[model samples]
Target: MLNAGGTPNISGFLVDAFGKHLVALPGSQRALPGGTAAQPAQVKFAPEGDELLVTEKGTQLIDTFSVGFTGYASPPTPHASSGVTPFGFSITTRGYAIVSEAGSGSVSSYDVEDGKHLNSISAATPLGQSAPCWLVTTGDGSFAYTANAGSGTISSLRIAADGTLSLLSATAGRLSAPLDMALSSRSKFLYVREGNGAVSGFRVMPDGTLEPLGSVTGVPPGAQGIAAR
Candidate 1:
């Protein structure tokens, strides 16, 4: 790691997407907080971009970079708050973030993370959404969905600036214990895994509304996650 602000040294081995071993940068410094051991819940590389995220406690934050993955220009940017428990997060094609709130079972939206946390519920609006176990963004990043397992369905919302959501017309049909979902690579379809080992498919409309395509014939039990080509 190169030095600009705080001297950063990677504590772990340098690896690529396939976990292949790679030689370390000469005389690298570990990235750490001032006088404290760094605790990172997650670490994602931004080869095409120049931003990083590290989750601590229940808050997810942003860490900026210079050239390569080094220390931040300043401190981390706190993306969201009121996260009863954040289990996971996903970024859209447009660079916006959809964070999973495991506690409230809702997903929060954020443009940037500072000390001040933005609205917890971000999609079509704020203070109107509910439990979102996980989220999947479209290729355009204009829309996203939350697996509302509490109500056994999915909550569809459109993302707005300042981490706000605008509820779109035509809510999707019911999904029992929906935990996760995936958008088609072409952004024309969605497949969700519901409780009781059922997979639901929906035709993604241009207006960000979902039209149920119907469930797959039969899947194995304990279906939890999915991906599409």
Candidate 2:
């Protein structure tokens, strides 16, 4: 397991089956430009490789870890965020990474191998979506989805051959403050958790659209996390 610390360091932990920690590895500090402390908000491993991608909310940057988790490498290129804040990201099976920009209400794609920014799709205003805090992609890397908390909706997108994002559909989620999401193993179902203590499920369509599967109510209020098997 990897833990993001307040000091902007990442610590690795080895745990046994019983969920007990067996060993704690030395923490590694992310070297951001200008030596700014990038408070790492989320981390995801490459879908087909050993690389790890981390989102730095404070500095609005993405950092990659070398294979075998040895060292940190700043992206070969720089991404001008224009004040957009990156929160969560997911790597695709096709060696691409998609990051959710909360400040800009958009999702940007990048080449994972070289950290090259490819294209970005706006999920706000004209698209009728806002504040996309979390993102998830299909196992085949054909589609991607964002949980738009600001507009209480979800936006569906299609991944082109060259790793560009094309908005497919943006529909009202009918949930309050949808924060986090997860997908079923076969990528047929999507489960979302709302800040208002509700869990909603959806059936992913062939065209990357979402069909409501109702929701479970009465969950303890302030529930903010979710996962799937």
Candidate 3:
């Protein structure tokens, strides 16, 4: 966990399942020489279980941490400048990291082990979808879905075996601001949290399409995060 809002010296924490404090690691003083402070927005372990990827929202960079958090590497401008604001990311079973770029309204893929840029699919390329803030991948790692906040839609992309990405489809999402998303354990369903404090559920079709199952009401306000067990 990153102390994103901390001042002077940002830090990372090693937490346990029960939310117990385990270890605290210090963050780099600066993301780049004489650059802005580092503010980590999201952290995810690589699918291969050997590396960690952290999104520095403040510095617009991705920080890779070695296994056991023993080493660190900051890739200078991993994603395109258009997609600099990396907000949410998901690792594919094949060890590819898919990151949602809110600034550029695109989704980018990277090699989890070496921090190499793989490919990027724009939500605005053929479709007018924009501001994809969050993403979730199918259990099989064959497909990915991003919640487009600006266009209020869901953009689907097909993930090739070699970690390449291609736009598949964009469908209307029944929400104002789709912020976060999660896939069911078996990848049978997808749940999205909207800005209106409602959770919308969709059935994940075999062809990587979404079938709306309506929304769940009565959720608390400002509910922006969700996960499927």
lDDT (CA) per prediction = 0.55, 0.70, 0.69
The 10 consecutive residues of candidate 1 with the worst lDDT sum are: 32-41
Can you rank all candidates by TM-score, best first?
A: 2, 3, 1
For model 3, the stretches where C-alpha displacement exceeds 4 angstroms are: 7-39, 69-82, 114-127
Model 3 lowest lDDT segment of ten: 27-36
Judge candidate 2 against the unseen true structure and give its global Cα lDDT, from 0 to 1. Answer: 0.70
For model 1, how does the per-residue alpha-carbon lDDT over 1-229 read when each residue is reduced to its tens digit? 3222333223323555576757554434345332132223334423244555443323333333223444333333344344555544566544555666655555566553332233344532332345666677677777777777666767677776544656553246576667678888888998888777778888889888888887864677765468887
Return the candidate ranking by lDDT, descending.
Answer: 2, 3, 1
| Ten-residue stretch with the least lDDT total in model 2 | 118-127
Off by over 4 Å in 2: 1-5, 15-22, 27-37, 69-83, 114-127
Q: What is the lDDT of residue 22 in candidate 2?
A: 69
By TM-score, who's the top model here?
2
Candidate topping lDDT: 2
Instruction: Judging by lDDT, tell me the better candidate of 2 and 3.
Output: 2
* Model 3 lDDT tens row, 1-229: 4445534122344556586857655653323211347655677767765566667566666666554444343433333322657777888888877877777777777765554443443332333477777888898999888889888888888888987778888664557778889999999999998888888999989888888999977878855589887
